[model samples]
Target: MLTREWATLPEFAAMALPGVPETRALQKWAISGNWSRPEWRNVYWRRRSGTCGAIEYSYQLLDRPAQLAWMQRHVVISVEDEIAAFGDDKRYADEWRMFHEASQTKQKKALEILQHLDRLHRLMEAGHTLEIAIYDVCREFGLKRTTVMNWRRRVKYVCRHHWLPFLLPGNKGATGPRAACDEQAWEFYRSDYLRAERPNHSDCYRRMVAAAEKNGWVVPSAKTMQRRINELPTAVIKMAREGRDRVKDMVPAQERDRTHLHALQAVNADGHKWDVFVKWPDGTVARPMMVAWQDLYSNMFLSWRVDRSENTDAIQLALGDLVEKWGIPQRAYLDNGRAFASKRMTGGAKTRFRFKVREGDAAGVMTILGIETIFVTPYSGQSKPIERGFRDFAQGLSKHPAFAGAYTGNNPMAKPENYGSSAVPLETFLAVISDGIKEHNSRLGRNTAVCGGVKSFRQVFEESLAQVQPRKPVAQQRHLWLRAAENLTTNKKDGSFKFLGNRYFGSFLNDHLGESIVVRFDPQDLHQDMHVYSMDGRYLGDAPIIEKTGFDTTAAAAEKKRAEKLLTKATKMRLDAEKALSPAELVALMPDLDEDGEDLVESKVVQQFRPRAVVAGSSALALDCDEEQELAREREEMAEVMQLRDYL
Candidate 1:
């Protein structure tokens, strides 16, 4: 190694080693540099102590004047000998990597040339002439004279360039200047070539050339056009030709923000029409709709329900299952569907609605349960997170071999050859769906959000379970979870209301006679007693069925007897309360009775309660005559009853 002492030395006169070409050459190269002795020594000292900041090369020590002097100076050093003595520089590691990873054919030829150069260098070091060394090396390596000359030239090129042969351009020193084409013309040609119905390279080239000729512009050959087309990025070309909907998936996607979310914190519900046809129980074939709820944070599907058509009932059923199995979600993101927006799902808000809405309806199911509902934009499937799970389900389950003939393509134009030829049974479809759902939940690597580093949806959901703060539903209010329907008129006679063609009686409805009240009931099974609420969601008592006659001998009789007993007890209680009435009030109930037990005239108590007579004229004589006539009529009417009613 060269030390600071040698680097700062004024001349080689004091340290002469004439026989050592390497030493003499280095001394000459150093002295030729325009650095003052102290400056050169300072550089070496800094490098030796590792105090220089990011300065790797010896050339960095020279200023402008020193650089010019050093470049112009005549100096001789065995480049190969110095490289061998100092070993390879780690600073050029990246360059060596590029060389080793070069094309296989170029690497092989470069290695052969390097071996020849190494042999020649050794021969020269042993004090042999160039011609003699080349002859000896060629004989030893079994190479032709011209080949030896080519290898020597390759060595000289590497020595001058300080780069391997493989790292150089493959077509170096070949042919004339490259072919050229107008850039604007090429861009237009590329656009036309990469259309949905793409054109061939040869055709594009021909069209471009014709256009160029007409415009008096130069155009390249077809081969050049083909190479340019190949150079275009595959993904960009696919996007241009195939449309974004088809090729967008090929591009990398970013993970959604779910930092503040936990399992069951927010859930998304959406409906997907399955691609397979199934034989329904009614002997008709149809595609079933799947209403699914997925956790936003964990990517786990909480629950799902299948039906011939998606409706509010199905949505509630799916959500109910989710709530029961994996606690209720704090917030629910729902797609803008007719079923999801139905009053039963979202009708319970008390505030004045901005959209056309029904009045006097109870809070929506989500509102009743304390779950915040967010309605996604209409027709925007990407807005809800559950859509991705449906895509995965279609790929995993709907394409099973059991549904081969029934597998309808997602798009009409993409249907299979045997589409609609056969139908899968409903039971079989349901069984397959169940199995598929299990497998989907268990499949690993779905936690792309990296929540707790879990690999599967189930694992991710379970891991985040502790972070959930769920609002539990009360058991008493569980049945009221469905949507409320239209209001009905309460019967004034008995305070009973008609619902689904059945009469229901509730004592609480007595005060709300003739008023319109909203009724909420399960559409699927109206057999359960319907819940009644006031126009303002006040809990009115439940009404039971008024009549039950068919196929009920024992139960009906028992219910009737129980009703009669309650009625008798109520009558006794009323009679006991009436005992506190005064004698005059009690006498008001009895009137003069005829022998045949009939009263011919109105009782005085009843007559006093009637409205006063309106007179046609208000003269004193006329009033006196009318009064006398009324007294005479009363005497005439009561005379018969007075004679027959001896008890009075």
Candidate 2:
């Protein structure tokens, strides 16, 4: 092909034209330079000489097809020869050998090399020699020629071995100067430094030095020791320095997935001591205890009670308030505290207080109400969602201006500026808590993390209540669920019942005297009326308070003395009710009795009518009626019998 027509040919279409030398000396130098072009290898008609003369080309003598064929064959041969003769330098040769050896073990590194092989291979396919290809790759990737060469060797090794190079494992950042210290020194450092109450860095360093010198080991500098301690895993540091209970503060709180729970489906109850000082009814300053039940799904405070102490009675009062307002909960999550886990709250178990119990001896409130009880792990506050609500409660309500000067800190180290300057009354404290809880429930943003959308606590709760039917206690049957009950016998004479040194009386109980019956009353309201129930759980009428014998300043002196005297009498009556029937007493109640207080002998006729059987062994005897004797007695009493139908 002609030089002018070379541009039209596919082979030379993408290449820049080669320039001619300006002088004969330059041309001669270029011809003798032995500079073979990778693209020129396809031009077989070109010729060169070792003289200061222009080279001649004769490719025009051949047709286009013949020229194209020569270009293809020679280009392929040149590329093959270049790759075969590459890596002749000693450094390149060593790298190539090492690359092959590493292919079996350094699979990860080899794979990384393969990632960049595409760009390098594309340049070589475009008629560039191996050296030019490596240089172009280095420029394209902004990598050094040596790095490019190493990568090329790795690629070739991977192609040959059909595998990649392995990667080095990651190392921990704690493998520094501290590792030089002995295990004994580490133990001393951990005990003295990484404890529930951690010591200061300088103190820990000084102690560590002393321990190291005694143990014949090198000690770490204060700065290095501090860094080492800081470098420890956050979880490890929290658990070691603050104990497992406080480790939750260091970790991110887990958002509970509560889509399955509905409002009133599950409620969590826990007691918290108000950090602020409050005055009790009897004029004493102390932190009042607050027990509250919160809905798990909506985070709404259902009910709460303020008391001087935490006990099962307080818990029941709070729970009962919720039942009265929102209906019964399906499940209750409680802490593993003594008050929450008491028999009165959780029911008696086969094992409690480290003792075996008989079946049916104890019945818990949850069991009676058919509510499931879920006790969180001991000391794990985060497990109960109410704890988070309580934190907000303390900061919002307990810190109100009304409680100014009375605000105490949540912990001993965080006392307020006006700590102990004043105190709030119990009633005022409760009022603040109640109002704060109402605001919290109605406030927006409680459902920010909820899936449906953002809403207030009350909105979510009301929506949930709309979807499912909640169990509500019947008004007439409230007595069964409102109080803890026990079975007691009524006084046979006046049908009076005594509990907690108080007497309860009912006219309907007269028929139930000497019989076991269930009595229900609130322990907190001993002076109030109580509901009476039959042994079979049938509700009787309410029993009114007959007298406030436990503690009553209104009673006169004579009345007080009489009330105290009834204690022994009530005990005697209770014991007598439990006494078993004697054989003589049973014989006295038989037929043919005399009105006078005297025992009569058995008549012959009466003996014939009454059939008797004697026992061979003991003093016991069995009684039966003889059919023949009974018929003879009826025949003799026929004349004395009157017709009841005619008299009517």
Candidate 3:
């Protein structure tokens, strides 16, 4: 398309004047009209190749109609049309590879041969004999006639078109010996060398040689075995030597799209134990586990709790804080850890595998609040987004200036020189963590999908929050996550139970005394009331802590008095209601047995009894005087033996 810079006399004549088909007639007309003048804006001339004389004219010198004709004749409408017009073939795939690998001189020679072939094809297309075409190409390219024929013969059988690759000089296949080792020897070497134990190549070669000597097989050299190992695919070698998990890790991980999620719509939770040492309130030094919940959409750290270790209580409280402050999330991506899978958090989930699933189990906080719980793969950090945030925290928070001596490296082997030299107080550690978390959320230009590398996480979260209505749990619903659940039985005597060293009692518990019920309470605040539920998940009532006092204290006396008053009031109410119906009135209220005027039903079977006779007698006692004296002496000996037995 208007690509040619210049056109010859015959080309210009055929394009500019369709009527003047003869080049000699067009030249005569141009001379008679004197069209070569500079003011005419036509017939601009350019020197011919390898000649001082002008032979071509610029296409711009033609009139509008002639230029249009030329453009229409040569215009390329599409890129594919242009490529197809060049007759480019796919065979160049191999040709270019061989050409690149060949020596510089060989590469130059291959290009020269390709140019000669182009000319030879053109000459042959013009009705010249093959020999004559080859001779002309050889004469023009300064090559021998035999050399040109030999290049053509080299590609004659295999490649009919795009035969530049086959025409390349030098060995086209692999070099060196073909059969270095037999199948049996190769198999033995592979088995010995490509093991999970990963033996060295030289050692494996020596072992293979020893085995070859005994088996009468030919073995290859150590270098040859090493080369073969290198030729094996990396994945295959890794699978054989490094194990399946290592090979699996080499594969790219799946990416998740969270563009549709909004703030508080979904969140992820995980526990990370900080490497920095802190002195706990109990006077013990240890690394603290921070259970954190992050908003999935904005990647913002919504809430967190620090404890001596990861536990159900810490996770529950952290989730509670998240719900209380930012509203309830629709879904939670959690770690497959015992704390995250606790019955208190995910009790009734069908996918929960940590505890035994049972019928009529109390629903967990997530189940009660209608939030979906998704457990990530166990021990897989990539499955949870919070792990990345925790990594960032580890880099900044753990290495803070306030924790200089207390900074313990991520692993034992990476510990700093001053590790264990000192420990920060728990209060100071918490304060620093609070400041760090604030700064992390408020930092500008968060390079996340939601932030678009322009806004902070807090800004992104708040913007989304403004556009969506997140579920907000009321005070009663908040207890579902804020409190831990336990199946406990109330005391049979007073309908009260001991929990966390405190006695909890409720008047409603009197009806459920000695019966198993679900009790949910805040572990951090034992003084607050606990929410009670039946085993079948029905809310019973709240049980307040029964505060203790000295027996002689006025408070104790007042409490006793209050209890007595309550009992008296309850008994009076019951008695008054009962008295409303007198004994006779109650009897009258009962149904009369003879109202139908039917005879009483009798027993069908008879019970038999045996008769007994009784004899009554009052006989007078009489004894002789001699007999009486002997009886008196026997009685005295009996009395002495009784006295000795009593003394012993």
Candidate 4:
């Protein structure tokens, strides 16, 4: 066999290049040397005649030494060699598919047969008899001669490049056994098994058998039914056996990116009931509900309060603690619980769907403080980050040594052996919870996305806090969270109002007497001054508590004296101002009467007077000196009485 004059890139790189064995590197070298140029004497390029249409180059592209090296290494190429070179391209598509579809064992056997056949062909080309070559090849491969002959006959007329599938030891057209159960039996089994009731395969098969006996239909064996059930998609099985909610649980939860948020910029609030029995001060034993606010950026529990039960007051105070400690959050992620959705917290929020929202409702804490309220889906734990911390707290705090015997499991079914044996006092339980939350925030190597498994939540929060300035409420705004609001009208007398069994009054309230006003007061401390607002929600002033005192006490006497002095001083000031204008000076300031002695102003209408009729035989009588004097004195007394009445 002669050495081929032209070679593909890979062939040239392998045979001619001694140092650069890679086709890419040789191609680079050929391009740098201009070997493919038409004017180049040693080499030229042409598209190889094949489906691939790759370029091939003459051996002269290499120097004399490489040319001789290539010729020395060349061997006589056989028809098998050419077929092997183009085997990947010449193989029929269906044959390739069949080869891949064949089992691994069959594929291995086919490969072994092909190898032995190649050996047999080489021996025949070496002038050996066909029968002898076949025997030798079969013996070399540990295969029988008959098997080797059969393999050859199977691919006798097939293209050598497409013989692998033919060599595979199986009936190419065979598909396996048909379904054992007929269509009716399959339908019955499927409909019976794939039910929401989730019937067992055996029971379903028995029922199907009974139905078959009645309906005269074929009955499939239990194994066949089980196999058919197993063939159903996993999602279909889960949806049928479990409920849709369980199926929904399989969906991945939304991943929130909180890196953009800073500490106290956004926070989430949630309430968790501990799994430990806590005896309240009132001697009632129950689990304590802890409402907490957690920073979203660092997953740190900023503030929390434990209460006998979850209520609006507990949630409000917890939020107050959060705001007082960490400043106001720009956004609060809350759930639509009764406590969080109360009028005192999120009343005016448009997203609050739990209650009837009225236009006249006062602004809630969130609205008053300008914090954006984001109401999460109800009962969805994934919506609140604080819930994850609550889970950790449940595992750590509920199982603490202090709560040993008091440990009430998270659910009724998971109760411990010593469940309800004892109860931890509320104070002790709160102390333990506080310590647990502190540790939860400061624990090292938290593997949260924000913590990065190295820093604690507190450390992360502080680090971010240094970079951003969070909005903080002023001292006056504390009432927004600390106080609950109520509409109350001041007392009709002295503008005082009774609230929580205490009377509140302020001089400023006098101006709003008998008018309905919004009163914001701390429920925990009713004695404190109540923040007052008008009906339209404008802040008036604080009304201090009017403490009750004994009437006989010196303190009461002193208070009375003080009030008398104030009233007397106020009256004296008004009298002095009035006396500044004397009555005689005020009379001189009046207009002078007309010269004719008739008033300048005249009545618009006039009427005639009727004469009085005297009694018949009436006579005019004359009085002596003493009688006349008495009559004149009586007349003088009557005039004086009339003047006094006009003055009064």
lDDT (Cα atoms) of all candidates against the true structure: 0.68, 0.65, 0.78, 0.78
Estimated TM-score per prediction?
A: 0.54, 0.54, 0.66, 0.63
Query: On lDDT, who's better, 2 or 3?
Result: 3
TM-score of 2: 0.54
Model 3, range 499-575, lDDT digits (tens) per residue? 87889988888788798888888776879998998875678889888888774576676676698789779979988
Top TM-score model? 3
The per-prediction tally of clashing pairs is: 3, 8, 0, 0
Candidate 2 on 434-460: residue-level lDDT in tens?
888899888875545542456888888
Model 4: lowest-lDDT 10 consecutive positions: 171-180
List model 1 lDDT by residue over 1-648, tens digit each: 112122322232233323222546545654576443665445442333444542222432433233222322322333243345436655444444455456777766665555555555645654567887677667656778886665455445343234344233342321235688888788868988999887777787788888888887777878777867766766778877787765756756655688567888888888899999999999999999998898888778888999999987888888878877777788888766678877666776443233467555545667666788887666655677678788887786889998989999889899999989899999999999988888887887664764445488888778789666666666655555553455788998767888778887776776788888767776776667678876655567676667757653666766766876886798778778978877898788888556887657865664336677877665655566778889999999898678535522
Evaluate model 2: give its lDDT. 0.65
Candidate 4 ranges with C-alpha deviation above 4 Å: 1-191, 223-236, 489-504, 513-515, 524-529, 544-648
Where is model 3 more than 4 Å wrong at Cα?
A: 1-177, 221-224, 230-233, 491-494, 498-504, 522-530, 536-538, 544-565, 571-648
Cα deviation at 184, candidate 3, in Å, is 2.0
Per-candidate alpha-carbon RMSD to the true structure: 14.2, 16.5, 12.9, 11.9
